[model samples]
Every structure is written in structure tokens, then in C-alpha cells.
Target: MSPATCVFYGCRHPVERGMSKCSHHRNRAPCSALQCHNQAYARGRCVRHGARKKCPIPGCTSYRRASGLCLGHTATHSAQAKARHLNLPPSTQPNTTPPAATEAVDAEWVLGLEPMDFKLPPSPSWNALDSVDLAIIHILLQDTVA
Candidate 1:
């Protein structure tokens, strides 16, 4: 037999006939906590009855993610959320890590950290790239468009 929607008009949950709330509404179950009543949210209980998870950080009871950790706890997740808030793709977000020192101090760098879609031709100071190149790179990056 297929499950049906709850008989309670305000409630929108669906339930099987033999699940927790069969007495009041065979379609949807009520929370399973004894003598404490509210509609079941999931896992046979309501949020107040611990149907949902709490953030893993000690003493936190507010919001939580599926991993049961609080949001913004993960560095990558926080960065992604910031990118989303600013309407940018996570990939396009600016890199926070300082670029690793180049192995070729005197080598003329015509390419970017990634394979440059467009290479910069050799220039006077561009060779033996050091801190100054960062300003030039910043300018180039600011000017670049997809």
C-alpha cells in the first residue's frame, strides 16, 4: 500500500499507515517523544525531539549542516559561501595563498601560474620575476575579462 498525505490540513507530511501517528492520522506520524507532542519532522521525531542535528562545536545549539558541523566551520565552505554572496564562481575567487617562489629566479616568465590563456611577451623587469611582478600581475588580472 502506498503512503498518503497527513489528514491534518495544516500539516504537509506524508506517512505510511503503520508509522508512529496512525491513531491521529494514519497518513502522517506525530513525534515519537512520550507525552511531548508536536508533528514529526523526520526520523520519527520533531526538531525539538532531536530529529535534526546540532552543530558539532561545543555548546552550540543554533544552526547546523548535514555533516553536523556548524556552517562557516570549514574554510573551503566559508570561501565558497563568500564567493556565492559576492556573485562570483568559487574558481574565480581570488587565491589567498601567497604564490610559491619561482624555481627559476633569472628565468624569463612568459606564462602565469596556470598555463596563461594569453602569454605576456618578455619585458625588461618581467624577467627575473620578483615582488614587482605582483603589481603587474594584479593590473593584468584586473584588466582581464572572459
Candidate 2:
């Protein structure tokens, strides 16, 4: 018997089942991998085959970018976000006074108190004596006494 016919004109290949038409006749679907969608520099899309280059920023997807940002506001917005996260004063914050020299303003002060280190404190053993001591402390305290 002859092999199955290609849906595409002038082609003679077996069409895969469940697909509407043969590969040649069908439109090429773009790669679904995130690799095809560039995330760096805000470029969340492949240049040629990708769509949905919408900016990942909340509520803002005006234009597509080779990078996610449409070139005009990427760096500016990113730096501003970083500053916000680090508790540093926003660069975009409008000042009533004339801008001060960068060095004159204390960066640490602007950023606020230093973040607490993440180290865990030493774990104390919870034994019978600790429980007994806690019970005694509870018992000694009267309800009315401050």
C-alpha cells in the first residue's frame, strides 16, 4: 500500500495523527521553553518566534523589549525598585530643596538602620529542670500582683 499523503501541496509525507495538518502545511508553533523567552534584561521573549513580550512589571506592559523593558525606563525603574527593597530612599522621590551632593548625604542613613543578620541563636536544651523551673515561676505569680 502507498504511504499516507501529506496535506501540504507537492509533498508526500505521512501526517501525524491528532494534528490538524502536516508540518509543512501547518503554521510553525514557536518553542515553549522559557529559554526561548529571555528573562534577563527584562527580555522575556525570543526575538523572532516569541510573542507576549509584555513587561513582567505589575500593571505595565506597554511595548515589547528585546529586554523586558522597552528600553526607555528599564534601568531607571530597576534601580528605583532595588532602592525600595533595600529600604533606601527612592531616587525618584521629589525633594523640596535643591538636590544635595551625593557624598554629602549619608547613604546608610538614607537606607535606614542596617538589616538584622540572619544567624540563628544557639538552641538551649529543654529538660525536666527547665519545665519544673517554668512551673515554679508560673505558680509564684499571683493574678492581682503587677
Candidate 3:
């Protein structure tokens, strides 16, 4: 029998024995690797050409950050944003200096009181009494003069 031919348009290359198409015209799955033409592994690239998620920034090899940029790019963008917000050139911005320290005052003096000299009024003992006793007391007091 005549050799099987490639089904693709304008291609007359003979197919391999017991196969559908010639080596060049065969429906070989491509690797996930950029511009790679090797057969795929289960529709993905092989281990030698494993796919990886990279930062969106061009030529950056670092892993992606929350904003799709690498860590270094993210920091650069943040600094640019801060500079824009302050309406100043990043290079011309003043250095941050620590604030001056102030004297500390006693907590008691701040509240206008002398500790241990002031005493709170004693708590009422009625809260300790039973509900029945309170009811009896209320009835007795209501029946008596003011």
C-alpha cells in the first residue's frame, strides 16, 4: 500500500510506518517553556523545563509579590508613592530625626492626689444580704416613719 501522507494543508511528507503523519507534521504537544517545541508532559512541560511563576516586571527573576511585582520593585514603588504624596523629589527629602525627650511626672501628681492619704468610702453591706432579707427590710422600712 502507498505510504500514508500528512493531513496538514500543502504537506505531502510521508508518515512513519504504523503512524498517522511524518515526524515534522505530527501533532506533537509543545512544552510550557517559552518558545520550546519539545513534546509536553501530560500537556505541560517536562521536569528539565519546569514552569515557574515569575514577577510581572520584565527581566525580574524574583518571585511575585502581592502587587505582582518583586520585593525590591515593591519597595521602590512605595518610595515613589511616598515622594509623590509629599510633593518632593525623593533625593531631596529631609532625613527623619527623633523627637526630643520630655520630663516624666508622677502618676498621682497628674491626678491631683497624694497616694495612701485619700481613702474611699466603705462599700454598702446590703449587696451581701439575701434577696429575702432585702425584701423584709424594704417592707419594714416602708411601714416605719421616714
- Model 2 alpha-carbon miss at residue 85, Å: 10
lDDT of 3 by residue, 1-146 (tens): 97777644345789777776578857655567776545556537643475435677788888765677777877666556545655797677534332123423334433645554544444343457799999999999988744
Report the number of the highest-TM-score candidate: 1
Error of 1 at 90 (Å): 24
User: What ranges in model 2 sit over 4 Å off?
Assistant: 1-50, 64-66, 81-88, 91-146
TM-score, cand. 2 vs. native: 0.24
Which of the two, 2 or 3, has more TM-score?
A: 3
List model 1 lDDT by residue over 40-120, tens digit each: 778998777878876766786756776556654544454455566557875798454322343232222222143334433
**Ranking, TM-score, top scorer first:** 1, 3, 2
The residue pairs that clash in candidate 1, if any, are none
Task: State every prediction's TM-score relative to the real structure.
Answer: 0.30, 0.24, 0.29
lDDT, candidate 3, at 130: 92
lDDT agreement with native, every candidate: 0.57, 0.50, 0.60
lDDT of 2 by residue, 22-135 (tens): 666555432344444222122333344344465676677566576667544565564565556656665554333322333243344346556444433334545566888888
